[model samples]
Target: MNGANHSSGNIIRLLQSASANAALYESGHLQVVRLGNQLFEELSALLEACGELSLIVVENELIIDGRPQEYSLFINRFTALLKARGVEYLKFQKGITRQEVASLVEFLSGAAGEPGEIASTGHLRFGYLTVAAGGPPSDSKGGERCAAEVLKELSLKELDRFTEIYRAVQRRQKLKVSGIADVVSGFVDLFRQEGAPLLILAALRDSDEYTFTHSANVCILNLAQAMALGIEGQQLKDIGVAAMLHDIGKLFVPEEIINKNGKLTDEEFDLIRQHPVRGARYLMDIPGVPRMAAICAYEHHAKFNLAGYPKLPPSWRLNLCSHLTMVSDFFDATRTRRSYREPLELDQITTMMLDMSGTELHPVLTRNFFQMLSDLKTPS
Candidate 1:
């Protein structure tokens, strides 16, 4: 017996306690596993002599049967491998509180995105609680992105709609400000009414191309903001067009700039900075790309404090969409990695956004946006 087995309590108790919230926990295997009070501790090599078998350590005890010794060796070898990579040893131990287990789903979402396999077969078989069923961290995210793409491909209607919306805003440079109420309303309808299906979107979060996937993420953010403000109907339709095409400007920037391997000079930086206005001008010709989107292109970079680029008139205040887009844009950009920097973790980003609320974001809207994001992250 290991010191943990001899000590006061072990992992089994912790796991069993959390099992009350059966939706969050599952007993992965069986074979007379008994645990201690502290589940997180490591107790191995005991199995090496016992031979091989399927085994799992819940919060307190060691459950083992069938080829127990080989199973022990497998675990020991696995521990060594993970340790070399800065990973801690073995099954999330007993020390991990019930709260931590619940948080695993959200933490995994950041890792898996939408196409992740958060749930084991056991979880699926035993009715688990899903945050936003089929949303990211579930099986359907990829499908959702595909559906959105399919809709984009088949809906010539939006193309014509965006064309008119695009031209209307170009005469002046205010960000497709016309018919936007309608654009946002439609954006609301897609998810709220169309039941646009969240599982598909969840699947993409798990795909290989995470940064590109941020595009759909941003669209969702923008859409949510539009709906919360009650901008519906034709106005919603226009917003959806604007939201979907907001990044169309990036098509013009060099891939090197987008995926640069390293830091850039002031000149390179200036060129990079031009994306918003550049995005605006590029869409100037796209008949279907909404001018509101074009405007978003120009003004999305324009900060609420009036410090961002394309320095507009002194009296100009950012529109609601532009202001909302600012947070979404930065959130997506910072959370994804570049060759030079690792992605900023979500908790860190959440903390940073708190400062920009009044200065860069629409205050109330920012609160709701953060709330939605936070709620989504809380384990189901």
Candidate 2:
């Protein structure tokens, strides 16, 4: 195996062992002490190999070595165990002492004792152990005021209006074209000011607000991508509207299923999978809504490899808007914290998307999107 993969595997194992050690210690198992020692030794070896090891927990993702560690069911549980305690990032450098490791395990044991409890420290230090607080880092330019304050407020307000429109549609009210148009115009203006970074930075903000926030983030990402691809004029508006309303069908879904903190049963998943068709049907009723919006709603989940949902009939194909929206959808979804998992680091998010480029997403579009993201994210 390659060094990177080997390191990735060791990190996963170390995390699993650490979590187990915490569980053992908490139950007053005497063997926990021995296990804890072993865990520290293993950690030391890993540090030797890698120079430093950091585990950063974002909303639903566990990041190691600036990469997204592939999820294992057990690993997700362990990640949740850490996230629940508000343990954001753990940094281990060479010569990290066993005593420091013991302290961390003890701390994890205490934290594991109380599920879903938040730790208060922004940065906690225990000898050689540094547990920096979690959540997205402060905006580089904004400092005390977030970089996207104005943009975020504007997007959220637009999202609120868009969300209400969806609700009105659900209630069978008259379609409001003016409000939706205003939202698209507002997004156009926002994009004009800073291009992709304006929306990208805003999207990177914490996703605790959910549905509405997710729609806005995806819309921004989609719009930015669309603009980059020379998709302009009415076409851009159509794509933006499509991106914003891509998940509107979720409103028809049960809150219990959509927001359930645990794994979904097969039946629950099937029900959840119907959103695209449901959303598309609703969009079809809007007097002036773009057909591409409805098309994107229907086929955003249809994979490039034809492995995705809302099974297509023979010889059927996906729309360009759907391909664009699909990439944006998955990118923003994984980038944001959801009810069930943490958000991935930027590198991790890109790597996963690149890996999916050929099969799950449009190869050219995915590659272009990553290039755009890289340019936007680079320090100016």
Candidate 3:
């Protein structure tokens, strides 16, 4: 390995050891303190050499200083711990102190409070990585791309990653919930920072991209609505994941049936309609998959009046997360170009949603969704 890679790997190993020691012993334990000091010294030297030290966890792998690390047990354990604690990125500035390093180890070890409590201090910073538009810019003009263009590109890249994750679910591979979490984290950060719905929503470039784009858009819309209602942190992240995976059952349906240009026969349509149950069951079986995701997967299509599908009992109360996902799903599906129809304008979709309110959709949530949209449209 090169000098940079070797140094980064060693630092991560030290971090892993320090965190383990912190978890097993008291804060002032000699081993923990010693490891923390060593970690501080090593990280300081590296930060001085490189100006900044960044460790990002992407898809369960570590990306050190923007370069991916070679897979190893230490890398896996360290990244897993970070992800478990909802941290996707860590940045160490040159002036970081030994005390701050010790605190970070404790935080990573779960001995300290939540990740949010220790998000940043002095030279230590940690949070989700913004979903990048792509690799380095092609030329000088690339720096001049407008915010919308950059967001659209980032949305497209996220769509590609989501599609891969969806395919993995279809193949019955272990669901990488971390991948979904990372995508949701990006949306959450975008909402928190930019707070512009239009810029965050992806434009449909091709009909073939609709499935993933629709899910991605729904996630964006759901996060917007959730944040407006004061939902934050892990709950907000769970809602985003649920919205993104609400349509995953469609992966089990045959491609021919899903992409049919003509009207579907009853049999094909029945199969299509069964996706909710299939998706819920699939999600429920996966360990660490949020129960909200399964509930939303099953209930998003069930309608507010309980007249939609799966023939639930009259007393079945839908989950709040499911209600939110339903509103987002309907909005995105109507706004996007489909095989059977062209995309609807905002006004047309608004009218349709208003007409369906309380019967096919939740009355309060639907109105809140539109009111949020109206607020977005109105000038400041």
Candidate 4:
């Protein structure tokens, strides 16, 4: 109905047409060539418009971009074809060509022996969905699970791990950077498999889980932001780790003061403000910890304009990772309900973030963050 849905449906139609033609005729036949050309043109236009086109198979459904399409003969056959080839996900980039489309259709039609037999090109990529099976029992017939369930289970496990890590920190134990890296790596894989940012973020349900839950949410948001900026590999994981530990200094602050519902005395507030420096120092002492983690922990509250706590020299520039964590921190903090205040609506939070852009937040990054949110919300 809408432009996004229309484009998605059109692409699927062209793909089905091309694959059907390829199955009936040779790859170089006139009809197969025409269908491949049409499909390539459609995919190229879609990629140019959206930057990337991701087709993910979640159980029995086909997810184009982030939205699952209605079940149809075309979708059913295509899903079966991909499942037969052990290909659960396909991403098309801007430089995809007609020849690549032909090859893809040929592979889908069983002309190619296996997925690996046809090496993925630069502009076309293939991946298999690795859905976690440990989640609660599925309600759907046949017991098939969905992406949201997988994310929730993984998020809860990560939260439990972070809770233990925080308690260890409170007991003055050495921080295990390897454990943090493992959690970040899991999140990166989850983000890659799951296309929707909103769906990847863990919901904050219980106030008691605030400390670790906030950390998890911030880590997810930071990963989404980093990936949107084309950051990948170890750099992406480092940013995620930085976000996870950004508030580690709060562990040193007394719980009574940290969770107090009433206004804090000036001394209490001052102690609260010292968390950044304290967290940074603690991280600095840990071997194998990413340096960016310490920097982010220290500068997350240091406003973009250098107007917020633990004052640094005006000439010093903030680390980009810290800037990212700061934005995520503010977003998750304002959105989650706390003892002192009720959670704000999404509209209010976005408006406030916009108002603080260029002052409390990096202007371009702030806008980019919102744009990412907008894209996720758009029907695809």
Q: Which candidate is the best by TM-score?
A: 4
Model 3 lDDT tens row, 1-380: 27767777779899999988888999989998899988988988987886667776645657665344666787888888888888876878788888788778888888434544575887887665432233233332322233445356465567678788888877878688888988888777766555454445533334276777788788888887766554555667888889888988898999999989999999999999999999999899888788889999999889989998777988787777787788988888877777788878888888999999989987867876776665333111
Error of 4 at 181 (Å): 1.3
- Model 4 per-residue lDDT tens digits across residues 207-247: 26777668878998888876665555566788889998999
How many residue pairs clash in each candidate at the backbone level?
83, 5, 0, 0
Model 4 off-target regions past 4 Å? 1-147, 155-157, 202-208, 377-380
TM-scores of the models, in the given order? 0.48, 0.58, 0.59, 0.61
Candidate 4 global TM-score: 0.61
Screening candidate 3 with a backbone cut-off below 3 angstroms (N, C-alpha, C), the clashing residue pairs are none
- Residues 1-380 of candidate 2 have per-residue lDDT tens digits of 26756765665566566656666556346677657667777777866775665565544655554344566786687678676566655656677776666666666655444643323232223111121233124355542243355446465556667778777866778658678777767777766764333334454355455766677767777877666544456667877788877887887888899999999999999988999998889889878888878888888898988788899875665666787788888877786777689878878878898899879998867876766654333221
Instruction: Provide the lDDT at 367 for model 3.
Output: 76
Worst 10 residues of 1 by lDDT: 122-131
Candidate lDDT (C-alpha), each: 0.48, 0.67, 0.75, 0.76
Expressed as tens digits, the lDDT of each residue in 31-100 for candidate 1 is 1122221222222232233221122221112222200122244345432322222222122322334334
Which scores greater on TM-score, model 2 or model 3?
A: 3
RMSD of each: 20.9, 18.8, 13.5, 15.0
Best lDDT among the predictions, by candidate number: 4
